[model samples]
Target chain A: METNTKILACEYQYLESSELGQVLTWLEEYGEKAAVLAGGTDLLVKMKMGNLQPDCVIYIKKIAELDYIKDDADALRIGATTSLATIERNEVVKTYYSALYEAVRSMAAVSIRNMGTIGGNLGNASPAADTAPPLLVYDATLKLVSQQGERLVPLNEFFVGPSQSVLKPNEIIAEIIIPKLGPDSGSSFLKLGRVSADIAKINVAVYMLRSGSKCESCRIAFGSVAPTPIRVPQAEAMLNGKEINEELLGAAAQAGAAEIKPITDNRSTKAYRQKVSKVILQEALQAAWQRAGGAL
Target chain B: MERKWVKIKVNGKERQLYLKPNDLLLNVLRDELGLMGAKYGCGIGECGACTVLVNGRPMLSCLILAVTMDGQEITTVEGLGDYDQLHPLQQSFLDHGAIQCGFCTPGMLVTAKGLLDENPNPSEEEIRDYLRGNLCRCTGYTAIVKAVKEASKAV
Candidate 1:
């Protein structure tokens, strides 16, 4: 009775739940056997490729509760199922958080973004995820909820490796909280892919906070250059509280390049990534600096 | 295998379907509804050949589960036009010779219609950006772009 050639060869019982409490109970009961379906852009692909064979397909997108973006005093809290298109076009996100906007803008394509959710992007935990670099630069956090309750985790510690995250089988990402940028601060995200809307070969995002010509603080992160999208604390340290100039930024970029471990993959070579990592970091730094009203 | 009954509005008509858990919306649209407009190209979300409008937005039908689309409104290429009268975008595509293999036509038309519905008059760059998910390997993008531009005026 095997009707082969079915896109999803794995057989699973579809459990439809439109309530968050019910979804959490199912996740707790089914454990790893249950695969939560968010946007299906990533989950369905893995299932079709036979990479995952979950016995239960939990369709939680109908839970209307997990889809809102709220602005608070010092941070913006976004529900997990909020579509990338929504975030990309969000007025508050675009006006202030340009890096996050540009990051979403440079993702897969319009159709994908129309269905793709921020939760799925981080949940799948692709090292080259376009949303990662910018979210890293923004110092975002996640609220993972289970039947037992919820726990908060920083975005920095979320990823373990390729296609991995700290998410437990019974837990679901309920919310993403991104801290608001301070005064005189600006951020930029830059990605280079095979084409305009392709998986990133290498992507960099830089955030700068400056007081006149003095660099108060900065964060530089890159994707597709390591096992996990990472921040270059060494580079940020070099520019921290220092009057940024071209020479200093160039030195910091070089230092940042020395800190990463990029691999040779189909998207690019280790050598190419190693060389351009420094260049993009420098350019990102200069752009961030300029946006922060710094002279350089 | 057990099948679930679901209701969907296809091209303005209400349709009730019995679908399996693994049944994709693309397969259901093509096989059951006889809406051959959405093609199965990549089987994945990469190629735009299976694009369809779900709830007023262009989405990858290949990735969408037919079971999950209960009560959703879908628009395929069949919804666009007929032999006698064509949708402005369909006519424009023909006028500009935008069809090469004809595999990507349905996706292109549906996605373009979705774009125009949202923004009545989109810039050339906007059209190109919106159509990034719909791939035409025939190198007929210039003509496709021209067609979309011309249709924007008529739409």
Candidate 2:
């Protein structure tokens, strides 16, 4: 490959965990002037496109402590640097976060997943991010750390807009905390794309708690149909405590379809996406409901 | 900008080089080490033309930085076998009519080698999944799959 050397100097600073404190200190000193590199999947592309040019890149992949996937008492704490391929193949991830595993499998081909990190995907904050909807349904929280300290924020509130996140310039997403599913909880993710392995034109994730044949609590989230991954409270309210039925599913789907403001993009038409999104949401909810031990 | 010295073991031989700030593994292997078996079809990670074994794992050389590969065992298509004694996969590729223009053959062979190294006996589905990253414009993948299957028995 020909070197694109026309672009001026872009330096890489490799930092092990022992050097993390110094790196954080440097970021604190420089503030927005530096960029943290977890996985080069996204940052490298942006830098090549001339979209980003940080004075320095703080390479954090060498920090073994940051690549952990630990089981917290009430949740699964996934390190920000965890590769998407690892998440897809992990036994615990497949068992607890089935929707996330399924969603990740549907993302770009295996090569990209091997290099892309969950934190990089979230930090990239694309509207069509495959992992966002599943994470949103699980009520995942992000552990953002800086020189000052660490703070936890719900995943739904993480993305402010397309290509924008609530993360601070100097802070890094250290971990993702996914709350443990209750005994009767089940979840499912559904995505519609042009190809079998393409970014979703529309994606939906449903998390439901069942009591016999009834839904005790529910969360419904949608992606690529809005500016950010959207949690449909009105739709969830329609399904909460309700039994699975054609009418209820239709009502919930309609509610979710009514909340989104999709636009005509190169991927799919606005009208077509809006119409197909409702169908996908219904299918996703039914699957989640069935997994929760609810009767169809 | 400062340079980083990375010591890599290529095909069982250790070599050291001082890489520039943004030098990628693909550059070091092709330019510095003079191993041209790994072709550069796409600078981006989309194509598997630059696939090489980094510590025995098939990875896109275009995406890996030379500096991050310090003290790593690297294997290219050339490392597998030479023209005098072709690897089983190379022989199979020739026998099964797997190569057309031959631009994508080296990558396919290396990727197949990686898969077979871990799994000597793989199902048709498993073989397809492992080669999902490799794109072949010719032969429609039937010959490629057959070639991998044949190499499994030999290697």
Candidate 3:
């Protein structure tokens, strides 16, 4: 029954957990040797490329409690194993979290979205992850669970570096909580890729809250321009409580671009990213502003 | 690693097979079941040459672990039809000359079948968007899109 195809190497046990308790028990027993498989979109790719070879892969897609999208009193709670396609098709997500919806829609393709999960996107912690910028602008929080207990970490602090996160070996990302946007608040996500299906070269997400003719609050985030998805607090401070206009948006865009640290990579040059960051931020801001009931 | 017995429904028939934890669905389909219609262009999911229907949804078999797909319904190109009686999409592809190198035709046809299953009548733009995962270097997509459009009417 054996063929000459290059199969995944390394001895491993595939365990499917139907309950959170069973996953925790398995994690506690196997800990460092176990890799959690949610969608297997990224994990399998990495394993095929010989980049990762875990001794055990714990599949959590069977955990019923871990695949849900519920609207709580204050925010939307998305289970870690919930597929991107579910979020893209959900009426609530489409209406309330359009930035997330757009980002999810713009990800790989229809089939990948059907199999890839929001948790897998965040868990991979790629600087160019399409969901991170939108999640950051949404002020999302990640709930991490372990055998000991659960802890919630703000999305901004969850990432430490490229392909790294604060997640402990025995802990799993249980849910992502995205706060509901207040009235007169609008958000948008924009990504510049080499092709329609390629990964983003430079992406930006903007969230704006307007009051009358003034900007009450603003949050700007960029991807592929830093080690992790980051918010431009300096840019936010400049736009807060200020009258938003084309000239002001230009200034904010420059400030935001100057604040990011981008490195030249295979996808794009650092200079190109630094330049496009401003353009995409301005574009996102204008779109968000129009959505927030602002003119021009 | 110990081999585990997994039961799955391929096309319409129920099947039980012993598989390793890391065995891919693509390998199991082609090697074990002799379903050679699904090609192996890219071992990764980037290319849709290994596309198949998992629970009536288009998915890359290259990325799916066979053990994790237990009890799921799978459909490959071989399940569609034979030379005597071809599926409507297959007929349209042949009529429209959409098969060039033919390496990517199976993936394209399977993915198009999934799209038409979900959306009986799709606009040209919708067909392009849905089949963006399936890459065909031969036909430049014009004839394939036309074939899907023609098959939509027939189906």
Backbone clash numbers for all candidates listed = 0, 0, 0
Alpha carbon lDDT at B12, candidate 2: 96
True contacts kept of each: 0.66, 0.24, 0.65
| Model 3, C-alpha of A283: deviation from truth (Å) | 0.5
List per-prediction Cα lDDT, in the order shown. Answer: 0.91, 0.83, 0.90
What are the per-residue Cα lDDT tens digits for candidate 1 across A1-296? 33333367778989988899999999999999999998999899888887888999999889999999999998999999999999987999988888888899999989999999999999989999888888898899999999999999999999999988999999999999999888899888888899998999999999999888889988999999998999999989999999889999999999999988999999999999999999988888888888887886
Error of 2 at A195 (Å): 2.5
Q: List the residue pairs that clash in candidate 2.
A: none
lDDT of 1 by residue, B56-134 (tens): 8999999999999998999999988999999999999999999999999999999999999989899999999999989
TM-score list, all predictions: 0.97, 0.92, 0.97
Clashing residue pairs in candidate 1 (N, C-alpha, C atoms within 3 angstroms): none
Candidate 2 chain A weakest ten by summed lDDT: A1-10
lDDT of 3 by residue, B17-81 (tens): 99999899988999999899998887777778999999988888888889998889999998888
Model 1 per-residue lDDT at B47: 86
RMSD of each: 1.7, 2.6, 2.0
User: Lowest summed lDDT over 10 consecutive residues: which window, candidate 1 chain A?
Assistant: A1-10
After superposition, which runs of candidate 2 have C-alpha atoms over 4 Å from their true positions? A1-18
Best by the DockQ measure: 1
DockQ of every candidate structure:
0.69, 0.42, 0.67
